[model samples]
Target: MKIIKLNAIDSTNSFLKEMGQNSTLKNFTVVVTNNQEKGRGQVENKWISKPFKNLTFSVFTKDFDLEIKDQKYLNFAISLAIFNTLSNYKTPNLSIKWPNDILSANKKICGILIENNIKGTKITSSIIGIGLNVNQEKFADSLKNATSLKNSTNSKYDYDLDDLLLEIIENLKNTIHLLSLKKYQELETGYLNVLYKKNIPSMFKDRNDVLFMGKIIGISLYGNLQVELEDEIVKEFGLKEISFA
Candidate 1:
């Protein structure tokens, strides 16, 4: 793995994507920054973190040859990798929110954004951007839902940043290997087992802003969320179609 460390940057994902376009970055090439300005998550959500207090990085993967139909497996694999890393740290209540957000005890601790390079119907490469709240203590009022490892655990983390980064990469390597071997069912099963709020009733808002209660059954093969609404009706909703209430 090639690692690039930056003191501050606009966005690690943007940097690595630009690099991937200009050069043949090796598989697992990582670009991490102490501070990320203008960092983004799914649906243009801004990720805010104090400089040098979190894990903000992007990784480039190449030549994976993943099928478009099974692309969500890649998302599950990456989420599982981060989940495993945090679980090792004894992070309380680690769970994967729908579409790959990492939560701890009902608070968000990590976000992942994956961009793929596709040729015809196969994914040739991917840029996996991750923003993990590590040691930050205070957050802006607008980020009330955000928490970090230090804040969640009530103890200071003295581990090196690269140590966690390398650990995630190692797990990612194993996941990618599974994808290469077409182990889709196994990966999906592992993902659902740790899925947040699965089989539990919760409140959600539909795209029209209507509030309703539903139970998460399982995600569809294409990664759409399946919710069993009142009256026992199950429906699938894609990204942006639903949000926690």
Candidate 2:
């Protein structure tokens, strides 16, 4: 349960990955930064980090079955962890978007990126990178979809970075421990309940630039997104083949 707090770092996820690669790191070991120089999101999208204003951290976990491609559940796991942490602040508007984005009143409150190092069925480690807009006052023009807790509360949501990390790390540990016992059906159901694109037929941009107005069915074990086409055809796709509008 050790946390490596940094005044600044290139990327929390990158740092944690390197840490695992260098040695045998324990589960729940976390890397946190008040300032990140380069933060990457899904599809190589850049996460604009505002120093001391946002929460950027990553946790290393070795407690997962690593089966069931429903990697979406992992997203559910981490989102639940964050949700449990933030919900304690009396923020009832906080919610999670599908595929792994946290939102407060439809504006992005945080983003998650999951990475894993696998050797066959054995995963040496998994990195859960999270970026939460905790205290930022404003975002750049490009991040118009983002919001922060400070903005939501109209009061300073600032806290000691070390303390915040400890809270999130504990939530993460408990989450994984439960999942280790196959007790994630409830969280997974909760995540799907709040999906941003549930039952709505919307245009999605696939990896090859293909567009489809499909309704999401659910997620497969491998984390492949299951979408039901308008023509009543069911198609499942991996991460390379899907993203929200």
Candidate 3:
């Protein structure tokens, strides 16, 4: 539970990973920064946050000895942890967009990026980066789907970032404990229960840019999105292969 607070950093994930490479890092060690100069998202997307107006942090943990095939459960655990934490704040219409984005009323408020250190089919450690838009009211026009806690709740008072971070970390620790106990079914069920757009007919665009209609049935064991097509075929799509249209 060691927390390292920084004024600014290139990326909390990068900083923590580099630190781990050089020395032993206690489990649940966290590195949080007020300004993340080069924060990253899934698939190399940049995580944009106003300085000191958001929660930008990375957590280091090596508590789970998960195999490569069971790694998706870790994703499920982390996503559910954030989902549970935000629910406590009464985040309206909170749901988990597949693979760990936290959405409120279908607009994203939080994003998680997990980097696992693997060796011989086992994940030895994990560096999890989280970016949560807290009090920022304005976003670039380009980020039309982005929203913040202030915008979502219209709260006049700013959220205490430190308190929110600690709450999320506590939830994360509890969820990961379930994983360590191999409660895979419980974790997956919790994740699917809050999954966005589940069982609703929706449009998607594949990497080929071809549009199609499908319903998100569930997620594959390996963390792929399972969509039921019009032809009654259920297909699993990996990241970057399909996106909501």
Distance from true location, Cα of 143 in model 3, Å: 1.1
Candidate 3 overall lDDT versus native: 0.95
| Candidate 3 residue spans exceeding 4 A from truth | none
Local accuracy of candidate 2 as per-residue lDDT tens digits, 34-133: 8999998987988887898778988888768756354556677788888888777666577776678778777888888989777765555689888888
Against the true structure, candidate 1 reaches a TM-score of: 0.97
Q: List the residue pairs that clash in candidate 1.
A: none
Error of 2 at 175 (Å): 1.2
lDDT tens readout by residue for model 1, 1-245? 89999999999999998987798899999999998988989989888878877899999987667989889999988999999899998999989999999999989999999999998999999999999998888888888888898887788555567788889999999888888888989989999999999999999999999999999999998889999998899999999999989
Task: Estimate the lDDT of model 2.
Answer: 0.78
RMSD each, Å = 1.1, 2.4, 0.7
Candidate 3: clashing residue pairs, number: 0
Query: How would the candidate models be sorted by TM-score, starting from the highest?
Result: 3, 1, 2
lDDT of 3 by residue, 1-245 (tens): 99999999999999999999899999999999999999999999999999999999999988687999999999999999888988888889999998899999999999999999999989999999999999999999988999999889989999999999999999999999999999999999999899999999999999999999999999988889999999999999999999998
- Comparing 2 and 3 on lDDT, the stronger one: 3
Sort order, lDDT high to low: 3, 1, 2
**Cα lDDT for residue 131, model 1?**
94
Least accurate stretch of 10 residues (summed lDDT) in model 2? 66-75
